[model samples]
Target: MRRFSRFVCIDWSGAVGEHPPGLALAMIGQAGAPELIAPKKRWSRQAVLEWLHGLADAREDILVGLDLSLGFPFIDRGSFFPQWDGSPDSARSLWECIDRLCADDPHLAATSFLRHPEARRHFRHAKGDTGDLFEGSIGRLREVERHQRVSKQANSWSCFNLVGAGQVGKSSLTGMRMMHRLEKRIPVWPFDPIPDSGPVIIEIYTSMAARAAGLPANTSKIRDLATLERALCVFEADTPAQLDRVDDHATDALLTVAWMRQASTVPALWTPQLLTPEIAQTEGWTFGVL
Candidate 1:
């Protein structure tokens, strides 16, 4: 029998009116099942680090998916700031967090935030023959749009829609930090568009759906929430599992607030994909199992 692996998908977006990236986290594993977690937003770097620390504590084998640039773009490594305290409207704390973790972990020893690399090479979206976000069904396809073809650009340029004029650096730094953590083996990168033998895609929209109905984070009444959470374990043939202590009420409330607040502008921002058994030997994925 083939062994199963679990994955975590972390879809990151910058916080509103702040340079810090907003994150969407998903835990996928055991035959392609996915478990969605509560989303969080904070202005403090310490808060970001603490959140990651908590995740690390919860599941050490989790593969974290990040959607930010993970390297220093225009400066030397030594001159970059260290020991970020999250004070005075600066990204120092965030940078420092990445620096320390990468420094301590061998997998993350590749480099620091001083220099960044491209993540797309490791992942690509499914595009149809006409070259659109592939719908996979081929029948009288529509013409391609001007923006359909993706090209490489600076992280700052890519995230210009979120970070604004001066925050590209933050995007790059955050990406570097995320990769560093993954490289250190503390976390794994599972955001690749292609499924991996070790990870699976995360169903982030379910959480939003749960929040829409005002269901409890851990309730028996919300059938959707229960199904979604259970879907996280469907891929596994073994490990029947135990009931997780989920606060369904809280989850519903939070998702409701986020949607009402117009967080839907970027629905894809909340969706994440995990590494799965299929991805290890192949590059395609289907939604039938996990």
Candidate 2:
């Protein structure tokens, strides 16, 4: 298998509108600093999905990472949500369920599914709005997530967690919808076999990449070029010029893409020892977790 020639990191958003919060993208090649890919208008979850399709259309041999949970906790509980018959058996089925339920949702938002009377029961929602079956944020981690914590690499929140600033429920749900649509077009790592020579997408947690760049867990965000350049240096990447607008979203995408370029060289990430075929089909592994 040949190494990827290009890399891209997307700071995804699950916000419910045409314009979403914290959505950004950065890309890089074999050598050089990452560059942000932005549209004239603010980014929407839909636009980002479209951009990925564009990459596939161009036949780009790239490794792409999206900052979101690709699959929920399944192996730990025998199903995505224990005791729930509707709970999907595989990651692809889960994506289909979310997409079908949220098909009418605007901006690819998972609003309808999030509000589903039965479906909402698995999530920890807003203040005083936790579901009946909902466990706390730290309770329902996937197998790889548990290993990630054990390795002391990064702390992970359940995809069912929907409250507070760290909540990734919205992003994960909406992203699943995108993944459902992306289906046979682009191969998502683990769930689909990597194509002999094309782009492959994987789940990524930017915090892990930041830690690889020598940043602390609680203070991993880089909101300026100076800090971003320093982080890039950890990967021995070229430093980009200062940009007019700089935020953690832009910085996360920039730094993580560089990190992916460096991290892909490791032999273990592609075949994590703990990642069995069943787990990959159920709860996909994060690229940098190993």
Candidate 3:
């Protein structure tokens, strides 16, 4: 396993707006002090991609964890878009498909896929609406999501459900757009082969990181400085004094990076028995979920 020099966690947003409050990023290096990146700035998905590409170009040995699903539930059907004849067979291919379909969308937004007739049928985009698309699906949980639930007891929402605050479908689709671009410059964990050097991105769940920091499962967000500091301290990370004023997004980013820093030291995190070639190519695993 490679030792990463820097750890980054992005609290990504899937809102349709140009600048969503949910978009936030934080980073922590070997020094263990977390710092908020792009503070007070409303970021577009395009800008984030450019920044990540720059990091990869620099050959930075970093482990980047983005809070989004890398791929949808594919194991049961052997494909993400099973009904569609043009459905991609692998996760990377799916990202490429989303990118190609949403090529006209600005800021790497996934509006094209969301608005796609056949594709949109598989997702629930609004609250109070039932996701009838997945009613007859063979499995709702991706292999990794099932592992996360059984092992970690984390309630991971289906990537097909785009409604509600707990829903990650929108963010994940938008994130797939970003991943499609980033794959050209960086290696995405499980989906792509990890290079010997340079930046590598992985899927992350902030709640899992919070759990590793001893936070309760019900703690959806952390706004209190004391609680945030305690979470950072769990990994012996330095708590930023500015943490007191930040909102939940910033705090989540901070805690996630701290958790990533500590998680990098665990051998099992890099190589898990569940990470078979099939799972890697189909349903990507969440980093540190083991």
Candidate 4:
């Protein structure tokens, strides 16, 4: 496996207006501690994309992990938007579909897809919004999600569920728009073959990284500096003094990148049995699930 010089984790949000506290970016370089990027200013999705593009342009061998689903559940029908004539069968094609469907959305927003006549049928945007959406199914976990659940005994939410706070559907949809734009410049893992060099992106679950760092499952957010410092200590990472606040977004980003810095060294992370051509083309697996 190729070693990365920098590890970045982004805690993304799908909010429509100004970026929420949930949208945060954190990075750890080879020589320094993990710290939030633009800690003072809220970041719009467009701004975040520009920042990421700049990193790729700088020729840095970086590994970026975004806290969002790369693709929806596709194991059952071999397609995410099954039955729809134009529905894409691959994660990369799905990204293109979403980007094309939501072309008018500013800042890479996915409201267009959510409100799309046919696309909306597959997603649940709000509470009590019912349809034939498979998101409501009890055991619709993707292969990676199932692996994470069985191997780590963690609760993994379906990417199709977008109603509650635990749901990642909205964020994943918005992330798909970003991915479509970035795919040309930066390669996304599982979707694109792993490149021998240059920057690469992957889907990440922040909770998994936190659990790997010894944080309790019940603790939703790490606000205390001491607790956060201890978690960073697990990877021998320097804890930034600025992360004293109680925002889960910032903390999640910080800890995930720290965990990723360590995870990038593990060979199994890049090569898993679940990453077969079928899975890669249909349902992209999460980077750390295996």
On residues 115-195, what C-alpha lDDT tens digit does candidate 3 reach at each position? 877787677666554445654332277988878777765889888876667888889888988888876788888877788
- Give each model a TM-score: 0.32, 0.97, 0.93, 0.93
Q: After superposition, how far is residue 244 of candidate 3 from its true place, in Å?
A: 8.3
Error of 4 at 261 (Å): 0.7
Candidate 3: segments with Cα more than 4 A from true spot: 127-132, 136-139, 243-245
Where in model 4 is the C-alpha error above 4 Å? 135-139, 244-246
Write the residue-wise lDDT of candidate 1 on 1-290 in tens digits. Answer: 11224444444433323323344344444342334454344323334445566654554433333434332211212212222222112123334455564464332222342222221121111242122211223211101111111211111132111223323334444444543343332422122332223322221223333333444544423334455344322222222133233343332322322222232234333332332333311211111112
> Could you report the Cα RMSD, in angstroms, for every candidate shown?
15.5, 1.2, 2.1, 1.8
lDDT of each: 0.32, 0.86, 0.83, 0.81
Error of 3 at 53 (Å): 1.0
- Alpha-carbon deviation at 248 in model 4, angstroms: 0.5
Q: Could you say which candidate leads in lDDT?
A: 2
Report the number of the highest-TM-score candidate.
2
Worst 10 residues of 1 by lDDT: 139-148
Q: Looking at model 2, report the run of 10 residues with the lowest lDDT sum.
A: 238-247
Q: Model 2, range 1-290, lDDT digits (tens) per residue?
A: 44999999999998867888689888899987888887888888878878888888987899999899989998877888777778889999999999998888888989899788888888888888888888764558888888888889888878888887888888999899998887668888888887889898989999998999999998999877778888899998887765646888888998899999988888788888888999989999998777
Question: Mind giving the per-residue lDDT tens digits that candidate 4 earns over 90-167?
Answer: 888888999999998887888888787777777655667754655546426678887777876467887767777788
Ranking by lDDT: 2, 3, 4, 1
The per-residue C-alpha lDDT of model 1 at residue 256 equals 26
